[model samples]
Target: MTYLGFYILMFLGYINQLFFVPKVAREKHRDGYVPLYDSFERFYLRYVYRRVRDCWNRPITSVPGAEVYVKERVTHDYGWSFEYTGREVKSLNLSSYNYLGFAESNGRCAQNAVRVIKEYGCASCTSRNELGNSDLQVKLEKLTARFLGVDDAIVFGMGFATNALNLPCLVSAGCLVISDEKNHASLILGLRLSGATIRVFKHNNTKHLEKVLREAIVSGQPKTRKPWKKVLIVVEGVYSMEGSIVHLPEIIAIKKKYKAYLYLDEAHSIGAIGPRGRGVVDYYDCDPNDVDVLMGTFTKSFGSAGGYIAGKKELIDYLRVAGHAGCYASSMSPPIIEQIITSMTIIMGEDGTDDGMRRITQLAKNTKYFRKRLHQIGVIIYGNDDSPVIPLLVYMFSKIGAVVRTLAERKIAVVGVGFPATPLMEGRIRFCLSAAHTKEQLDYVSLVLIYNYEKDSFFFSLFMSFNKTFPVPSMAALNSLFCYRVIIFFILD
Candidate 1:
C-alpha cells in the first residue's frame, strides 16, 4: 500500500474507535483505579503533577546540573540527578526543598563527612533514647538552640513524622490549638492525631486569630474549672505554598494579649531570610525568645535531612524522653548530623567565605527581578516580592493543568497549586528561585515566562477547545515538535 493510503487508514480507524473508547474509559475510570491513569480519581490532581506524569508516561530521565556528588537538594541539580526525578531533563528544579542552594556543595562538607565516617563508623543504629544518644547529638542540639536564639532544641529524623507524632504528645484533648487555615499538612495531621479541640483562623488573619483567642479566654472564665491554661497559636514563618510571610509582630501581640504559646514553623524561611539569613524571626527583628516554641526542618535551607524543635530547656527536656516517635524512630545518620553542624556553621556566619550571607542577597535580587519583569507583563504574582517562592496565578483549574505540561518544552520547571492545595479558583505555578540561578539564567527564564504570558490568554482558550476534541497524544513525540499550552501561577500576594 502507498504511504498516504496507510496514513489515511490509520486516521479513520482511530476516529471510528474514539467515540466508544472515551465512553468506555469514562465509565470504567469512575469504577477502576488505573495505576498509571491518574485522571480518573475522585478529585483531580494539580496541573504540575498531572503534567509531569503525562510528559513522562513510561520513564523520565533527568540531566545533571553537576558531574559529582553531595546533598539531597532541589531540582535537576548535578549532584542529585544521578539523583531523583529519573527524567533526564535540564530544569531549574523549582520543586526541591533546597531553598538556600547549599545542597550543590561537597567540598568542605564532603571532606568532613568522610572524616566523620572514619571516626563515628557511620551508624547511630539505635534511637536517641537508646544507645544512639551520642555526645555529638547532645552538643548539636545545644548549638542549634544557641544559633537560633532559643533556649533549647531537639533534633529528629523525619520532619513530617516529627510533627505527626509531636503535636499530640505536647497538647491534650482539653487544650485548644488555634491553627492557621494555611498551616502545612503535617500540622493538620498532628492536630488531628492529638484529638485536641482545633480552631482554624483565617489564613494570616490576626483579627480572626484574636477573635478565637478571645473566645477561648472568655469560655474559660466561669464554668470552666481548668480555665484554659494553655493556648498554642500555630503559624509558619514563611508559608510553603505561596512563599508569603507571616506578620509575626501582630501575631505575637495577639498571642501576648491572649497569653498563648506561639509556635512558628520556620520551614522555608530559615537560612533564607533575616540578618545573616536567620529566618523570618530575624528579618522582623523580633526576639527569638519571644516565640514560645520554634520548629524548623533541616531538609530545607540547611543541606541535611532532619527537623528540630527549640523552646525553653524545660519544655524540650520534657519532650525528649516524653515523645514516643523520638524514643523509637532511628536517629538521624551521622552524616546528616555532621552536615547539620557544618551547614549551621555556614548559615550562622562562622565561616570565612560568607557564602550563606551572599546567597540571601542573591535570592532577594532574583525574586525582585522575576517579579518586576512578570509584573511589567501584567502577570499576577502571589506572596511577598522578597520571598524566593513566587506563585504566578492562573484562575482556571482545568486549563491551568494543561499549562503545566506545556512549560516543560520551554526547559523551565514549575509546580502547580490547585483544588486541595488551594481554593477552587486559586490555581498557580509555583516558581522557586535559588542562589544557584545565575542572572543570565534568570533573565532568560523571565523573558521566556513573559513570552508565555503574552500569549497565555489566547492560547489557553484555543488549547482547551482543541484538547476537548483530541487525544492527549500518544507517546508525545518527544523528539518531534507540536504545540501545547503552558500555565503559570497567579497570586495577589
Candidate 2:
C-alpha cells in the first residue's frame, strides 16, 4: 500500500474508535466496579484505566524559569514528536518552588557547582559513613548548623529518604507520633516506618492538636495505660499543598505543656518565609531551641538536592551513628553540596552584598502583590498572605484538564493538582510565585482571571464553586459520578 493510503486508513480507524470506544467506556464506567472474579474486570482495567487518560507528564520547560515551552502530548499514540518541534515557546512559570529565585543556573551557585564538579568529579563514591564524607560536606554541615542556630546538623543524600529512614532511628515501636492531618506524605511514611502509634489532629488547628496531645499523654497506650516511650509532635512550618503557615508559637506552647519533642519540617518555609528567610522559627520569633528537631530540604529554596536534620550536638552525633539513610544512602555529590553552601552563604550575606535580602524582599513583594491581585479579581485562593504557594480551586474532575490545557494555550505554566494530593472535589491549580516573576507577568495572570471572571467561563465556574454563595451547576453531578467511581476503583481497592 502507498504511504498516503496507509496514513489515511490509520486516521479513519482512529476516528471510528474515538466515537465508539468512549460511549462503551462511559457506560462501563458509570455501571461501576467489576468484581475481581469476573472476566470483565480485565476488560474494564484495560479500557477504563489504560485507555482513558489526559495529557500529563509532558516536558514543560528546557530549564526552570518564569517562562518556557512545553511539549504537547498526543492523546492516542502517546508519542513525543506530535506537537513539539525543535523550538520551544516561552510561557510564564508559576509552577516551580524557586521561592527566592536562587534556582538559576548562571549565578554564583552555578559557578561554585562547576568549580566543585571540576575539582571532585560528580558522585561522592559511597555513603557518608563509607568513605563519602568529604571536606565540603563537613563545611556544609557546619554552615547549616550556624544558619539555623543549632549546635550541629547532619545531611542526607535524599530529602524524602531523610525523613523516611531517619524516623526509625529517632523513634520506635512504643513511641507515639502526633502529626498534622495534612502533613506531607514523607512525614506520614516516616511515622509508619518508625512503627509508632500515630494520631492525627486537624490541619493547623492548635486547639485540636492540644486536645490530641492531652488525650495521648493522659490515656497512654490502647488499653494497658502504659506511657508511650516518646511522644513526638510532627508538623510542617508551612503546608506545601495548602500554602498555609503553621501556627508554630501555639504548637510550641502545646509541645512544652505536654513535654513532647517537636519535629518541625521546614521544607517549603526554610528558604521562602521570614524577613531573613530563616523559616518559621524566625518568622514567628520563636526560640529555635524549642524545636527538638528541625528538618528541611535544599531542593525548594537552596536550588540544590539533599536534606538536613539540625538540632543539638548530641542528637546530631546520635543520628550519625544510628540513622540508616546517612549510613546506607549514597552521599550528596560535591557539586550539589557546594551549590547548597554557596546559596547558604548568599542568604547569610557572606557573599558581600545585600543580594540575599533583596531576593527575599522581592519574593515577599511578589507573593503579596499576586495574592492581592487574585483576590481583587474575585477568585478564591488558598494559603496565607505571605505564602509563595497559591492554589486556586477547580472542583470538578473534568475542569482539571480543561483549565490546565486552557492555561497552557494562554502561555501560562501552572500545576493542576488532584486526588489524592487533595480531596476529589477539592482539586486545584497551584501557582508558586518567585522573586524572578516580574510585575508584568503577575499582571497578566490578574488580567486572565478578570477576563474570565466576567464571562461564564471555567474560571467563573471555579470561582463560583469556591465561593459557596453561588450554587453549583447540575453538570457537577455527572462529574462527581465518574470521580467517585475512579476513586473507589483505584484508591480504595
Candidate 3:
C-alpha cells in the first residue's frame, strides 16, 4: 500500500508536469543553458512536497522552552510562497532539541550568555588559528574535556562542521570506515570527504557490525588486496532520526577485538542521557578511554551553539593544526562558549548547586513517563525508553503533514519527518521530550493523542480491525493500519 501510494502520487505529479511547469522552474534565459536541477527533483519539490509544505520550517517568535510561540502564515498559491498572518500561537513544544530545557529567555545560562556578548561582542572576527581564538574558547575546550572524561578537546563554531571538517584529518583513502547505517548526514559527509572506504552495518545491530568489520578485515583493498591503513568504526550515541540509542559497550568490545578505532558521535545523547547526563558512555558505565574519539554538540542539552571533539591530548594537538575548521572557519563566539561553560558547570555541580542534577533527573523521569504513556496509547514509537528523542510513526506521507497540522491546531507543536530523511514508508512525527515539560503538560499531550485517536472513525475502525485480526496486536501491528485520512479531510475542507 505504501509503495502503491507513492507510485500513484508520482504518476499524478508527472501528468501535472506534462501540462504545466511551475513558475519557479521556468527559465528566463534558455539560450543553450543547462538545467541546474533534475526533472524528478523539481517534480517532487513542486507536486509531492508542496502539498504539505506548510507543516515544516515554522517560524518561532519566542524561546523554545516547554512552550513556544509559532508565527502563523498562509499560502495563496499552494505552497509556492507564504505570507505571515501576523498571529503567533503559543503551543506546547515537542519540536526543539532543548533536552535539559536550557533554551530560555531568562535563566543562569541566558544571563551569562548576555554578559559574555557585552564583554566580547558577537563575532570572533577570525579563525581559531588567527586572531579569533579567545580565552573563552580555551576554557570551553578544557571544560568539555573534563565533562567527557577525556584528556583534551577542541571546539568548532558549528556542530556539523565539527564532524564534516575533522574526519579528513583523521582518515584518508586507504582507511576503512565502518559506520552505522543510521549515522547522521554530517558524519556521512565527513567520511566521504576523508576519502575512506566506507561500509555500513545495520543500525544498532552489534552482530552485524562485527560481521562487517570481520569481512572488511579479511577482504582488504578492492584490487591490490592490501591491508587498510587504519580502521575506524563510527556510530552515534543516539540516532536522531530513528530515536535509537547506540550499543556502545558491545561496539567498543568489537573495536578492541578487531584492534579498530571507535568514533562516537554523542550529539544527541550528551548532557541528555545517563545518571550524570554525560552521554552513552556514562549511561552504560563504560570507561571513556575505551572509545578512541568522542564528538558532541552543545546545541542540544546545553542550549548553546558549536561542537567539540574530545580525545587524547595527542589527537587534540594534531587536530588543532590539521583540521580545516581550526584553520579556516571562524572561532566559536564568546557568548556561545560562555553558555556552554556555564551549562556544563551546572551539570558537573561546580556551581555549588544541584540544579543540573535536578534537570537530568527530571529529564530521565519525563522520558520514562512519556514513553510508557505513549506505549500504553498503542502507538508505534521507536527508540529505547531512556532516550528523550521519540519517533511516533505515522507511516504514510500524507499522514505526516496531517498529524503536524492537527497537533498544531490543538496548540501542540511537533516535527514531521519523511523521505529522504527516512525511508518512504516510515514517515513519522518526532517528539523531543525535555526536562522543562511538566507532568501536566505531558498528560495533556497524551490526552490530545488519545482524543485524536478516538475522534476519528477511520482510526477507531482501523484499531478495531487490528483487535479482531491479531487477537493481541503488538504496537507495530496496531500501527500498520493507523491512518490520518480523517484529519487530512478536515484540513483540506
Best by lDDT: 3
- Misplaced by over 4 Å in model 3 are 27-35, 456-493
Backbone clashes in each candidate structure, one number apiece?
23, 2, 0
lDDT score, candidate 2, position 155: 92
Candidate 1 residue 35 C-alpha distance from true site, Å: 18
Backbone clash pairs for candidate 2 read 66-93, 68-91
Per-residue C-alpha lDDT of model 2 across residues 1-493, encoded as one tens digit per residue: 2334334534654565567553332433435765434544433333322332443455865656666567655544532124445556578888888887877769788888999899999997798898898999899999999999989999988899889988888998889999999999998899898888999999999999999889888999877889999999999988988999999999998888889999999999998999888998999988799999999999988888899999999999999998897678999999999989998999889999999999899999999988887775556789899999999986654456667767777888788876567874576889998888999889887766554445435544444555563222223432443455566558758
List RMSD in Å for every model shown: 11.5, 11.2, 5.1
Global CA lDDT computed for model 3: 0.90
Segments in model 1 whose C-alpha atoms lie over 4 Å from true places: 1-52, 55-87, 221-226, 456-493
Q: Which candidate has the highest TM-score of all?
A: 3
Worst 10 residues of 1 by lDDT: 473-482
Error of 3 at 344 (Å): 0.6
Tens-place lDDT per residue, model 1, 1-493, is: 2334334534554564455432222333445653654442411222223333432222223322211121222335211123344335555555555666767545666677678888887887888788887777887898888888878999988888778778888787677899999999999999899877788999888888898878877776335546764678989988978779999999999888777888889888888777678888889999888898888888877767888889899879888878876678988788778878887887777877787677778777777887776665466778887788888887564345556656666666666676567775576778777776777777676656644544554554554455443222122321111244322232222
TM-score of 1: 0.77
